[model samples]
Target: MDQETAKKLLVEGGTFVFLGVPQETQFGIDMQCWNTDEDFRGIKMIPPGLHYIHYSAVSKGTGDIAPRSGIMHYFQKKEFLVKMWDKDKDDMSREEVSEESIQRLKDNLYNLDRHLGPYPYEIWLKWKLLTSQITAELAAKLSPESGIIRASVELLSTSDKDRPRGVKSPEGSMDQESADDINTENSNEAGQSTAKRAKRATAQEREDAMLPDLKPAPGTALRFTEIPRDKYPPGSTPEEITKHYLDQSYTLELMIEQQEEPLHIIGELQFSYLCFLIGHSLDAFEHWKELVILLCSCDDAIHKYRSLFFHFIRTIEIQIEEMPEDFLADIVMNKNLVYKKLREFFRTAYMSKVDGRLLTMIERFKENLTEKLQWDFTGLDADEEDERPVVVRLDDDAE
Candidate 1:
């Protein structure tokens, strides 16, 4: 920025004071943090807008940090906020600094100015993709009291009294009676062991029985709603299944609520994408995959939410382009839900007469996938005899 603009921003910008954090801590605003540092305070001249500040305390020996905690804050111009590190409690909490002390710090601002770093203008474009929809209003409506976006894995809690056998006890403790009963009942009447029953719960079972409880738990940083999925009756024909899905998916358009437009779902997508891809959170990733699948599975969805679906495609394209190569490879090689959804989109677009814009966008996305990942989805067959997608490899540059 030019000197004049910098001066104006300095006059109008907010000052965040973080006091007493020891040397070499990992913390900062989104996508930017301290490294090789000592006596960290906080960022200054911050733009008056919605921003997320996160931090983690490093472990003593192993150097493994604790789960990161984050809070979303809106910095009004000239706002001064103070937070102190509770080394004993192991957290950053708001502190009530006396006006005299605050004035002293303000007067000696030159001493602290050396520690302040500029907002990362270079990566703002990319960062905005994940956070642009997060308005101050939305943040205030949903964030925890502290306004921090802490990402942590949540395991479903199961009641020991009702939990089925073969599942480990919640407390990792097994009663002697239960162990004896299991051993006695291990063999069937015909002498075959019932060990086959010990399989881990399936994805569908986990989703059906568990996920609902963990979401929106009192301190959950982001609100992720359950994604809709299509279920077909036993012995239903493919045609009937498709019709049912289309009918069900069409009804989702009515789900928009006050302060939430159709495209606001994109905000949820961005939230889940970050939670999954960057936070390494399975539940968030599950929501992301389901959302994509729900949109792509319905051929008519592209028609109903054309612009939303178009944006969805572009977002995924960017995700695929920017994600680590190894992670993308795992997503494709494992035929995960995301990979399957992309395949399903190609199949749906091929079989139906989708919107021209959507069709072109999907084609371009497919071309990018083919070029970058060697995923060649050239044609699809939804016929009764052969309903699988056809993969035809062409020259690397082929459209």
Candidate 2:
């Protein structure tokens, strides 16, 4: 950046005032991360936009970093955001900062200037491309209620009503009454001894027991729109339903309706990708894959939403290229849903009528992937019986 532009940004860009952060804590904004030193404060001259602030607490004694946690904030021009770290919890403090403190910090900005790092200007264009579609409203709607996205979600035991049906409780000693019910006339002594053993178990032992059926702690899970399980609208004929299942156009329509705008679906796609790539959330990765599959499986949508598909092609091209090599290997080896879905999309596009421009872009995208990642898009429509998708239709008299 030129000096004038840099000076302009220094005046107009947002400021983040992070206080009480410990040394060696992993701190990051967007694509960059750093190990904090004693003099480190926060970021300055941040371009006003939706940015992800993520961190992982490092254990001082063991030097082990905890699971990553992040929050998304839309910074306005010249905005000043402040946060404090909680030493006890090894996380950001929930307590609010008073206005007076904020004003004081603003007044002392120059004295603290040296401690703050400038927003990484070099990566700005790439970051913009990755997050272009995400709006503030979209971010708020998809983010967890607690406003934090965690790589590892905290879990808590729930009441029976809250527990999902058909999921068995973790292995533990049975209650005395239940044990009594299990006792046969000849095994009364064994049942009594089992009950005694159960009684003798320590409270800490019970508390520490594995709970595979536990629920995610409230306000921590992402609020992604649920993809319809039925795939087809109600009252459709068996043939129509089967066609819907095979093409997934109706399913894509339903998903698009859930968003404020058709392109917000793409916004969510970018959001989920960034969440996974930067925030290290597997849940986000799962949502990203589902969105990709849904977008790729559409047939009629290819023509109707040519622009959406165009941006999608570019968006996913960058995402695939940015993916870690080991992770890309795993995707290629395990299921390879992305490859299969793209092939299905290409097959549908060739078999149907789509815009010439879109076709040209798709061809270029295919060639790029083939050249860069060595992905084969040849013979996409080949009739492989074993790999072919099966659609089941219920007869009218099935009931």
Considering only N, C-alpha and C atoms within 3 Å, which residue pairs clash in candidate 1? 70-148, 70-149, 71-147, 71-148, 72-147
Best by TM-score: 2
RMSD of each: 9.7, 8.5
Candidate 2 lDDT trough over 10 residues, lowest sum: 192-201
Per residue, candidate 1 scores C-alpha lDDT tens digits across 157-234 of: 555554565443334345566666668777658676653233345567656555333334455546665443325555
Clashing pairs in 2: none
The TM-scores, one per candidate, come to: 0.70, 0.85
Best by lDDT: 2
Per-prediction backbone clash count: 5, 0
Q: How far is candidate 1 from the true structure (C-alpha RMSD, Å)?
A: 9.7
